[model samples]
Target: MVSLICTLQDHRDDVNWCVFSAKLLATCSADKTVRVYYTKDFSELPFSPLSGHGYPVHCCSFSPCGQYLASCSTDATTVVWQMDSGEIEAVLEHPGRSPVRVCAFSPDSVHLVSGASDGTLALWDFTSRSILRTGGVADTTMVACSFSPCGQLFVSGSMYGDLRVWNLELKQLYAEKSAHDLGVTCCQFAPQMQKGTGGNVVQFRMASCGQDSLLKVWNISYTPHAGCKMQLLHTLTGQTAPVLSCSFSADGQMLVSGSVDKTVTVYEASQGTLLYTLSQHERYVTACAFSPMAPLIATGSMDKSVNVWRVEDGCSTHEGKFLPGEEAASSCEGGKMGGHSRLMPSDWSEDDVSSWLRQEGLEALVDVFKANNIDGSELLALNKDALATDMKVESMGLRSKIIRKIEELKMESMCTGVPDEYLCPITRELMKDPVIAAGECWWSTSGFHDCAYEEGT
Candidate 1:
């Protein structure tokens, strides 16, 4: 499902961030410069290597219209670049002059947010290039900020592992402290919006990766009368080391992450499932993004290289086909993806579990399961030892069959669209059934992807 297209070795230092617009791709580096490339052919822009910052650039983003690009740096400033000419449009200084670690443009492109190392956040009016509101948590570095689709709210993540929701005025509306252990590195809101339960509340989905080596998906629901609530949806453990960055595809169906493990991971955003763990980077994969113009991905690394990859239908690796930015952007409309319910199988009730057993022809155990009050969550925790010792199941054949089915269900919650890789949360992992690693231990171990595939499989 993922294949390397090319490796771009332009930056001399660590590639800190990478992003894409409709027709162009932009990358910033610790080398104190930003590079621009045409998506069609990966060619550099005429006025590229946009050198405006006095120090390393930490983040980069393109405006919705692709007319301007923004990059923030350790220089304690956020610079706006006129994309066509790569000219510096304005330099907005952070309120405290603390090194800005992250910046993001609002979905409407009218507002921008820059978070600093001093735990300060400045909201800017992009049109006037002026600061509008200043607020933040004390004593904690602000490392991440993302605006909800409605543009009425944005979320900020601190180095202390706290996730806070702020309104346009920069007032904290909600907070989830210790959202991640150790620290929170990045957070991004899905582009698409969803209506809340009963259709009155406005709901937003966000994905955050942290120093805890876990990537989590959360549902932030806001009701006009009730204010806001944050709920955890999934905790994805696909990376071996700290996850450095995470991004959602334009359609919000696919999610990709780069990690200190030197791997690029792709997932089904809706299900928190792992699709593929791409091990091509020689060093830590620090940045990753999906192109708004095509089913393509660009990953940047501490190895000082940027790798482009193509994601397509099925488990087979192939080159990516192109889609115009407009067409790709249009996919965000309706904000709904068919197939699969939002409530994952792990949330099934005891009755639901019994029904599923009947469907899978484990009817003989349905009464026993009902007596034990097994639910979807408990069902997923079942294992060979538990089945034999705890449940007293004597039939090895029945245990194996039940275990196989459980493995498949476990992967069904990892992501919306899972890839075909073994033990990957995608591709339904029809083959993992105790196959273990290929070329040697196929007779046992390793079977099923954890919840990550929801594409055209």
Candidate 2:
């Protein structure tokens, strides 16, 4: 895999989260400082440090437009910062009862949702700088909160393993689900115009991981059923230890999960099949993420290092394969060497469009609807026809073939162009200008890491 971008260390202790914003990388640490580094020059000095958290920060994130930074700490406080000036714009001290676990900005950047230990969820308005509403408790400490993609509804998960859906406009609980036997780790709304599943249905899903060792997926459709609060559609449970964190890829087609077991697993979100297992870290994998704009994966660990892995055509069985940087272009081929089965035939299904979409679109566009919701039937009908002879299917088949050939070419270049001495242990990531530790071990680096250094040494 190609490691196009690398992480640089500026924190002395564990790094909680690193956000890329407007050409600067801002990271929070257990050392209670926020350091901003330049992405282009990893060796350059960092901007001034911003410190105010009384305890280790749990998470830090940037706004959608990259204008502001928000962070939550174990010290019962959440701070908002001006990214350009590195100045604290607002400090929200929660009521004496709870320490904030997580905080997120709305899509418009006018509101913020926070989850705390007191079993309460709070919504604040940026303009008014006041709490607009406090979502009542179900006696479970809320660990994570997220707004639906449409911003019409919001949901929160708790330490008691409960999940609640709220009508944000009405400020009332609309639905609830007992998602896990333990606490829910995170929740996210699918982005708009996202293809794969739940297309334009105003639907959302929640991933709950606790002591259960499984990641449960729920289907929260807008159409509320009297008895169906939330649909438990799929459960991904191969982790040997508790799944501490889970995140969806930009397209929502893939899910990356980290666990106390020291392994990060990548799965097909729609199919729930384990696609890849990142086996580089020697300690508990605490953080993992997909680059929003690229196919690369970045993971951090208690091992005090960060490693970057890219999504290439190479199969899991071919983890250590690599081509020298100098040989990449001269022997260039598409990247699909033995990656997956040849793409299915275009006419394999016969229909190009999904039945659900056709039905939903016709119904939505047509004024006269049905009595029993014929829109669903219309969607099914459309899907059946589209699947029958969609040209895209044929294109997909061709793409698959091309991808496989590319992989073969990459492998060929690596085998022929690269010298034996230049080959590092193929770590499923490219190390541009790699510097192995004294012992000849490669590591994830932004700063000095003893364990990784020892391995290299």
Candidate 3:
């Protein structure tokens, strides 16, 4: 993981989902292609691009047995493909819907379950290529759904603040809980559960996040006569904004959460204790996962970057760290106290820049080249070479105009590199929220213990 063993850049846009099967890693992109990459980098083309989706691909998963592949698209269908041939073995279509948002293969590989934006859950018979049952929850876009590790149950959390625990075998609702006050963005079942110190037979636990700006954990216990008793055991507050994604570590000791607040927090499972916050992302952290084989945590963000961090290494802080010759470091002598000037942009102010806007002047020429969408780097080189000739007011005016034009161009370029669907819903320079950094140990927001009840009433 340290070396970035390989790079797969086939997708013309964002790669939203990536799933692994023993030796194969498959990625689904907004470019409407599912690419399969071998773990052992092939000297030849390492990725086989599987394309056919009529719309952007949203999610992809490999079967538990690692023999089959599944993907969901904005095209209103879920596809199951044969890994070796890039052939579609089954297509599960949902009518009266915008698109399927999530799809997963059960542990036994007998069933494929998909949840869509229309608030419908479709159970598919994987072997027969037929829809088993289609059920409706409140009509809200479903963001994420997962099959319980045991394959005995399935859970769907909606953007409408409803979390449904469904008995897959029984094909009925076991428990419906309002876990979030607003849309439930992400939810995950605990990897393991056991009877507690008080003899409370906890079968499983789940964590959910949403618009309420809090993470809620439920204690799920099965009773002989009452079906399942779901209790809200703990409400953890740290994220300052809605949590967009959450995942439980394989060992069940740690839980990881990514939020629109632009940070990732890892928590202790049993006691609902906050463990660490990983917040290196400069933009909204979209998805997070704990490695099934190691203590590594991976996070994807709107910063157009993916980061991997150590589980033991807590949240990344942007606070200043000592480094040599960095200008902003403490070691710098006499650079001016309270140095705000250093932070100003090079072209902070301009006056009489009209002369620089002409077609014949170097700055004017660059402006013309830019407006014509000519070679940008070539124009940049011409401007740099011309800058060495004079320090006249006319030259300065031209420079200012060129600078302004460049700024305008950059602003327009934002979010243009990726398809509109792949752009994260929350992305405006995401940073670690103050609350998430404090974890469960303290309410850093209010500067006290048990702060939510004190101030939030």
Candidate 4:
């Protein structure tokens, strides 16, 4: 039921990967530049392209706190940029002069781990801006690296299908195993779950996907005597083509995968059930990620677009029309289709309408009912002829009201906005730092200077 919100076509070439932060989205491209846009307003163009890389930028990741951004390129370098100012904080060069493929920050945001084409991994300490450690020269290109939620361990995947786990504190290899028949393209750890009283106990798991058209989940547990043990939990198979990327939702209850087959698949994490298969991308889907603060998924594709999908109740749902070549099939069946059906007043019962109103809003319900010239009792009575007459007279106004009400409810629930009292009177914008003078009016430091003469006059 996933539908495209909008197709972002800012990249001149293929978009390699995309990462989301609280307020911004950073997209790296094969055009040798990285572009960042406000997640709240995608229509606005990027202020400027991040253009220091000499080659194509392969991947980008935001720190856990969303204060900084890290981007790697085929130019054998990784650049750390301050998110607010877009200033380069550090430029890390690969020790072996190999192209950096993937990079990620530790859960504590103290260290950064990056994998390179020369079969090596480097850990950098951001505070000191120096390489803390470098290892992994097993003669296979390392493509992916991820730190576990506990920040005590990390996992790396190689082009030769090797997956290795290492102790972050000791820098010692903990386990090595073959993960797939082809190169491993992506790896990620599931969010830690609360288990015991007071949420002190945590459960850790990991999932990996690769060019072998397979996805595997593993259970990771620590033992005092044995150290660490990773057990295979499940093998997921659905994609006919190579799976390029996979990500677990913020709650770790859902997993999403994108592949060269031009499809994105959502899976129930507990039972491994296929929740939905999204197929709006005309070309290979290169990357997919779940938003940390919202029920949305963002997918980047080689078709030169980024699509946002809505996830609800462990299923995908959207209100938009189907894209070109997309089939209008049932979601219960096993194919990429739009399974959403528009609901009519006749389709809902009195109880259903009442429940919806309680959950959505009584205001919206009242507005829609008034616009359609139908009482709650009449709506539940299944009077289609009366509805048809009302629709014919004010069809556009009724529809517009319904749409606007829905949008208003959604925005009120999903986004948090700044208070009006915190805004400056002159610019009508948010005041970063406020100073109060006579009358107790708030003004930013710069605005205070401009209004000082006025206040004196």
Candidate 5:
């Protein structure tokens, strides 16, 4: 079901948390540094390690678009860094000067939240980089927090074994007094919305791991009349020791968790059945995150090593990796591309994109793309970030394939060496059906493939 692809041993101390963007991997450590890696081969970035935190870093998260990373530390602040240049974007000080234990960016990347050791939570307007409001639980350390897919609600877990849900206005919507018996270590909302049982109601699923040695799945629903309601769906007991962290696959079909027993467990999220139990970490497993667009996962531990795993669906010969750019482009040329793109990919309409997706054997995704109104230009703009985040593609392999085909289309549109004879005379586009007229010298340019000549002589 899974195989270890590589191991990263860059952090000098205990690895606290691990997170992934479309293109990069970030891991924070008790050594007071955060290391970034390229997921293609698990290679370190040029800047390698980020050392802005004055004290040990406890958690790390990447912004929605993979352009920035946020890391919180015992130094009493959460620092946001530009992903490309490895420079600090802003240093956000937690309220009450307490050690920041956790941080997360909303689905839209418009807001950020940081939880402190004193139970204080600060919500920031990410664009303006200013605190918007403050709220928290009483007498407990804020250790876990995650935003809902709708970007309007978020849930925070405390050391007091409570899970509290809050809106952007800092108003408490729901609170489960003892969601976890001992304490909560981590929680994350599944990235999709489900229709509630009634009209105008919305439902969501969230996964949380705790010191109680249990991995719990929850269903939370909200409506104007009833506010928010939470119910436990399943409690998995596959891990022997305390479960420290948990994450959901982009499509929400699977869940993964790391535990103090030095093992990583993968679960079939829908049925709560254990899929695999990985024990590659030497010390306590502390962190785990699934790549946004690939069937790959990274897990970090107290052993000071990050293990990169390739999840298998039992089909790919590429061995859990994507095809090289050149090979992918050749596949696109060999009729793997969508329908009627015809070298003018940027001129595609919503209907055209649908037709293309259907032709590419992605009929299941046609509605998903149509709901988003993906046009020619929008389809061309589909990167790993948008495919996984905005479109919610489930299979890591599908995300990689779609992106590869899109890149090939982009390359075709940039080609400037087309011969004049192989181009349509009137449209100046590539001629797919070139033909000679009755005179043999007259080229048929009338709307391509058809000859139209009108004259009064």
Candidate 6:
């Protein structure tokens, strides 16, 4: 029942990475541009694209507070932008002209750690807009870096599969270990947890994945004499192909990973129990992340698609429960009861087609139908097979008509800009057909109606 909430097709080439904040999602692509979209309404176009990178952008990260975004490209530079205005705040150029492989923000949101191709890790202090410290140089390039949730430590992974831990406060390397047989692709400090000691003290842990097809969790502890100690806790092995990315859920109780095998797996964080294996993507899964403030996981793939999945009670959603005959009719070829397939039935009734479309959450297509002067109720009443024939016969002319109508509507709306007060506080987007409760704020009618209904407002 892990239904796809939506698929974003804005990127023209392979999507390398995607990151989510409280309200926005930032996706960087081989198209040499970064597109930021509202999480609530994927149908809306990006406010503007970030386009200064001369080469394919490798990675993008948001500040802890979601006020800024940092992206590194093969152009040997990193650009930081104001999230609200999309204005470049700083452009960090590597003196050696080596591409930055990855970048991360400190838990305090004041410092940025970047790993570069020259085997160097640089810590930049945003307040000064300059490099504060640089260390952890290896013969091979650096691949990944992550700041611990406690803000006391940071970790970096090298192309040689070595993992290095550094004390953020002291700005010095604290520990180092050979982590993987092959190059380490991703490393992340798990969300803070209180592992009860015999007394009342608590310890922390971290996780890393590599091209060796292994995921390792490490126990982190502090000692007066040794300063910091990291011990191998668990080794997770299920993926047959190289593991590319991993993420810890908001509660730190679960972990998810994507790999070159075209699958996403969810795991129990502590004992590494496999929970669910989602095999929806058609190509190598490149990136995966858990939302900080919601029970959602977003994954991007080499297939040029982004999928959002709900992570709760075996990935079931309220809207996914099927009625009689609905399951078989909507099931794609080769799709299991809980899986998704691209092949859909062609001889479906209009109601079946509409329900299938709604289940797939194709908001853009729904918008197109609304803009084309087609009656929503009537469209839902027409036979899908007939509609398919009409579409094939008049494809180009129908597309042109829909485009013109959409453009006309956009111009009309532009002439009457939305009132500032009616915008959603979280997304800062205009509320369409807003509905308000007694003392609560107004929300868009289509997207957030579930929240309001759940609250019994």
The top-ranked prediction according to TM-score is 5
List the lowest-lDDT window of 10 residues for candidate 6.
332-341
> Could you say which candidate leads in lDDT?
5
Candidate 1 shows a clash count of: 33
Per-residue alpha-carbon lDDT of model 5 for 32-128, expressed as tens digits? 9999998778889988699999999999998866778999999999999988799998999988999999999986577899999999999998878
Tens digits of per-residue lDDT, candidate 3, 23-52, equal 455667677977775533422223367876
Candidate 4 per-residue lDDT over residues 1-457, each given as its tens digit: 5556667887888888888764566788899888887656555334447888999999999876566789999999999887667789789998888999999887656678888998889988866768988898567888878887656578888888877877654355455457878789898898552222221222467889998899888876653224556778888997888999898887688899999999999998777888889999999999888766556788999998888777755321112211111121112111111111112223444454554443222333444555555532344332334434554435554445445434332222111123535444433333444444355454433322222223563
Clash counts for the predictions, in order? 33, 33, 3, 0, 0, 0
Model 1 TM-score on a 0 to 1 scale: 0.70
C-alpha lDDT (0 to 100) for residue 77 of candidate 1: 96
The alpha-carbon lDDT assigned to residue 52 of candidate 5 equals: 98
- Candidate 2, 371-406: lDDT as tens digits: 223232232223322423532334444344334422
Across 1-457, the per-residue lDDT of candidate 1 in tens digits comes to: 7889888999999999999987889999999999999888999999989999999999998876577889999999999998878889899999878999999987667688999999999999887778898999899999888888667789999889999998887878899998999999989998756654543456789999999999999999875445789999999999999999998887678889999999989998788888899999999999998876578899999999999998865221111345434433311112221112223555678877876675344777887788778887688778988888888888999899899778646533222332334433223333333323433323222232323233444
Stretches of model 5 off by over 4 angstroms after superposition: 314-457
Q: Candidate 5: lDDT of 447?
A: 21
Provide the lDDT at 407 for model 2.
34
For residues 143-235, could you state the per-residue lDDT of candidate 6 as single tens digits? 888887645568888878888877654355454557888788888887663333422223567888999988888886642223456789999
Worst 10 residues of 4 by lDDT: 332-341
Model 1 stretches with alpha carbons more than 4 Å out: 314-321, 324-457
TM-score result, candidate 4: 0.66
- Which regions of candidate 4 fall more than 4 Å away from where they truly are? 44-46, 193-202, 314-457
Model 3: residues >4 Å from true position, as ranges?
1-15, 37-45, 169-177, 193-202, 310-457
What root-mean-square deviation over C-alphas does model 3 reach?
Answer: 25.0
